[model samples]
Structures are given as C-alpha cells and as structure tokens.
Target chain A: MIVIHADMQIKPEKREAFLQTVQPLVAGSQAEEGCLRYTLTQDVANLNRFTMIEVWADQDAVDRHNASSHFTGFFKVSTDFFALPLKAEKFTAADV
Target chain B: MIVIHADMQIKPEKREAFLQTVQPLVAGSQAEEGCLRYTLTQDVANLNRFTMIEVWADQDAVDRHNASSHFTGFFKVSTDFFALPLKAEKFTAADV
Candidate 1:
C-alpha cells in the first residue's frame, strides 16, 4: 500500500473555513475506488495542525486521486488557509 | 479511535539493525488486543526515515501498549540507532 502523511498548518482564523473546505475532499476521496483509507485528523496538542493520512492501493490509484476534481478544487482555495506550505511524506510498509 | 504517527530517523549505518529490532515490536504489538492497526513504514525518499502508524481503540489501549515489554525493549536499544530524537504526534479524527 502507498501511505501518505500530508501535514497542513492552518492559520488560526482559517480553522473553521479550512475544516469546511476539507470536508468534501475527505468525503470524495474516501469514495474513490482505490482509496483504502483517507482521513483528516487534528493534532491533539496543536489545534491548528492537521494531517491527512491517506492509504492508496498503488501509484496508479494515487495518480487518479491527484487528478480528481475534489483534489484540484481543494488546492484552488487552499492557498489562503495555510500558515505554511503543505508538507507530505510517502511511505511503504517495511518488511524486516 | 486514537492515531499516532511516530517518526524515527535512523542512523544510516544502523538501518539493518534498526529494522531487525523493530520487527519483533511490530509483531508483538499487532498481537495485542485493541490494536486496530500497527504498521512500520520506510520513507520512500529518505531511506533512513521510518514512521510507525498506529491506531488504537482508545487511550487505555495506548497506555497498555506503552507499558508493554516489547515496546520498552525496543527503546532500550533504540537510542543507539537513531540519528535524531524520536518525534511523535497524537491525533483524532476531525468531525467537521
């Protein structure tokens, strides 16, 4: 599985708007065929920090998700909500 | 549900040993009750970086896991393998 940890730091004032903006993206992504898991989470210690934990079947699935309207639409309005540029890390299960 | 993203940056030279050490912890944790998900993943871009994405049923489950022998055992030897101090973030699902 392809796991993505997308970290976002929202402006304090934009918190409510950010939540509203991301709702559809979360719902829409979860409905996608290859989306194994897609969830938005708020950091327990930092209310302004949020992370989107995404699990996809593979790179192809991620490619499609990136191209979806929900994904694109979020980006269009997301610029104003950010305190910093988004940071994302991609990982794959470790087989020790 | 409670989610934890524990990030570890291992020493490049100790990568092999670190992987071996974490293997048992992963197995042991997975066998524990209330462990909804417990996985260790290696960063795709940074080979020395790894993250443990853990999902627990509740705070009680996390407390138990924290006190587990397997968890403590790994930590005993983990200091030598790490390139930096461990960083962890606790999160809960966003309801908006």
Candidate 2:
C-alpha cells in the first residue's frame, strides 16, 4: 500500500473558501478506483494548515488520482489561495 | 474522530535500529481499543523521515495511548535516535 500526504497552508482569509472548493474533490477522490482512503483534515493548532492523507493500492492508483478530472480541474483552482505551495510526501510500508 | 501526525527525522546512521525499536510499539498501538489506525510510514524520498499517522476514536483514546506502558516504554526509547525533536500535529475532521 502507498500513502500520500499533501500539506497546504492556505491564506487565512481564504481558508474557508479553499475548504469549500476541495470538498467535492475529496468526495470524488474517495470514490475513485484503487482509493483506499482520501481524507482532508485541518490542523488543530493551525487551522490554516490542512492535509489530505490518501491511501492507494500503488503508484498507478496515485497517478490516476492526480490525472483524474476532479483533481486536475476542481482542486487546482484552490491553488491560488495557498500561503505556500503544496507539499506532498509519499510513503509505503517498510519491509519490516 | 481525531488524527495525529507525529513526524520525526531520525539520524540516518540509526535508521534500521530505530525502525526495529518501534516495531513493537506500532503493533501494540494498533491493538489499543480506541485506535482506528496507527501506521508508521517512511518517506519514499527521505527514508530518514517518518510519520505516524494515527486515527483515534477521540481525544480520550489518544490520552490513553500516550499513557499506555508500551508506548511510554518502547516508543520513548526510539526518540533518542531522532535528529530533530518529534513534531506532532493533531487534526480532526472539519465541518466542511
């Protein structure tokens, strides 16, 4: 299994709007094939910072996700409100 | 539900040992009653960095997990290998 963490710190003024914009993307991604989980969470200490923690079957699953219309279309529009560029980190289970 | 991301960058020299040290803690955490998921993932781009993405029933569950002897005992041992202090960020599902 592979997991991807996409962290974003949106401008405080646009946080709510950005959240609204991504709601549909979140729901859409979760319904996609190979998506084990796709959840968006707001930081308790810093509400402006949010992360989408996604679990997928493999790289192909992730690639398909990024290419999906929901991500490429709707999610991209929220980029303008970002305080900083999105930071994504990917990981997989260790052999151990 | 509450989710916590406990991120740590471990000393590269002690990576393998640190992973071994935390294996039991990971297994133990998963068995806790309130734990929905507790997974340790190594960043694919930076193996030395790891994050424990945890989903709990609520705050009380997290408190119990932190107080659990297994975590207090085994998990703390691995902290010595950390290059930077553990950075824990907590979050919950947003109203959106």
Candidate 3:
C-alpha cells in the first residue's frame, strides 16, 4: 500500500475559505479508483493547520490521483491560502 | 493492522513548545514492539496544526502504546497547549 500524508499551513484568516474550496476536491478524490481512503482534518490546537491523509491500493493509484483534473484544479485555487508551502511525505508498508 | 490518524490544533504561539514536548513521546513510540511506523507532521498551509500518523501490527500494539507511561507523561504536558480538543480517527485495511 502507498500512504500519503500532506500537511498544509493555511493562514488563520483564510482557513474556512481554503476548506470550502478543497471539500469538492476531496469528494472527487474519494470516488476515484484505488482510493482506499481519503480524509481531511484540522488540528485542535492550531486553527490554521490541516492534514490530508490518503491511503491507496498502490503507487499507481496515488500517481493517477495526483494527475487527475480534480487535483490540478484544486491546487490552482487552494495555493493562495497557504501560510507556508505544502509538505507531503510518502510511506510504503514494510514487508513482515 | 491498525492505523491511527490524530489531528491536533495547537495554539499558534504554543506550537513550538508542544512539538518539543511531544518529540520524546514519538521517539519512544517508534521503538515499541509491533510499531510499524509512527510519524508526526505539520500542515503546509496551517502553521498551528499537526498530525500524528501511526501504523501498528495490530490493535494490541496500539493499546499498549497508549497505555505506556511515556504517552501519559507527554499528554499531561501537551494538553495545555491545544487550541481545541484533539481528534483521532482509526482505520483498518479492507480485505481485497
């Protein structure tokens, strides 16, 4: 499995606007093939920070999701709300 | 396997302090038995939000980690820094 954790720091004043714009993007992503799960969550202590956690069947699925039009459109509109650049990390499950 | 995604909102000014307090807890968690992976990440757009992603071999491992003394100590110190209550979600991989 391929897991992606994306952390975004939205400006405090722009958080609600950012979430509204990204909700549709998340909805579209959840409907894609190979998307095991996709979730967006905000931090309790930090009003301006959010996390996007995604689990895919494999790397190919993740790649396809990133390349899809929905992601591109969301990125274009959502980039302006960031307090800092987005940070994404990927992990592959280790064989037992 | 059990996967946990914990989203925390830290007061903007208390973020650094919270991180400092939680670093040791993360290190301790990573060393525990049945811990596949544990990672703490901040959001790119939200400066005050952070996420804790943990993958365990099973539910037992997660339960043990939560009950460990290290986690309890860290929680005591870190709770005061939260801007809101922490929210945690759990997911189990679906059989193919």
- After superposition, which runs of candidate 2 have C-alpha atoms over 4 Å from their true positions? A94-96, B1-96
Angstrom error at residue A60, model 2: 1.1
Model 2, C-alpha of B79: deviation from truth (Å): 24
B1-96 in candidate 3: lDDT tens per residue?
777777789998897798889878888998999998677766544657777887788878988998998899998788789999998767664223
For candidate 2, write residues B17-63 as lDDT tens digits.
98788877888999999898676766433568777778777778989
Question: Judged by lDDT, which candidate is best?
Answer: 1
Candidate 1, superposed: residue stretches over 4 Å from native: A94-96, B1-96
Clashes of 3: 24
Query: Per-residue CA lDDT of candidate 2, range A1-96, in tens?
Result: 565667788999997788788877888898999997676766433567776777677778888988998899876587689999898756652111
Which regions of candidate 3 are displaced past 4 Å? Answer: A1-52, A55-67, A70-96, B94-96
- How high is the TM-score of chain B in model 2? 0.91
Give lDDT for model 3.
0.79
Residue A37's lDDT in candidate 3: 64
**Tens-digit per-residue lDDT, A1-67, candidate 3:** 7667677899988877997899778889999999986877665446576768887878789889989
Candidate rank order under TM-score: 3, 1, 2
What RMSD does model 1 have? 15.0
Query: How high is the DockQ of candidate 2?
Result: 0.04
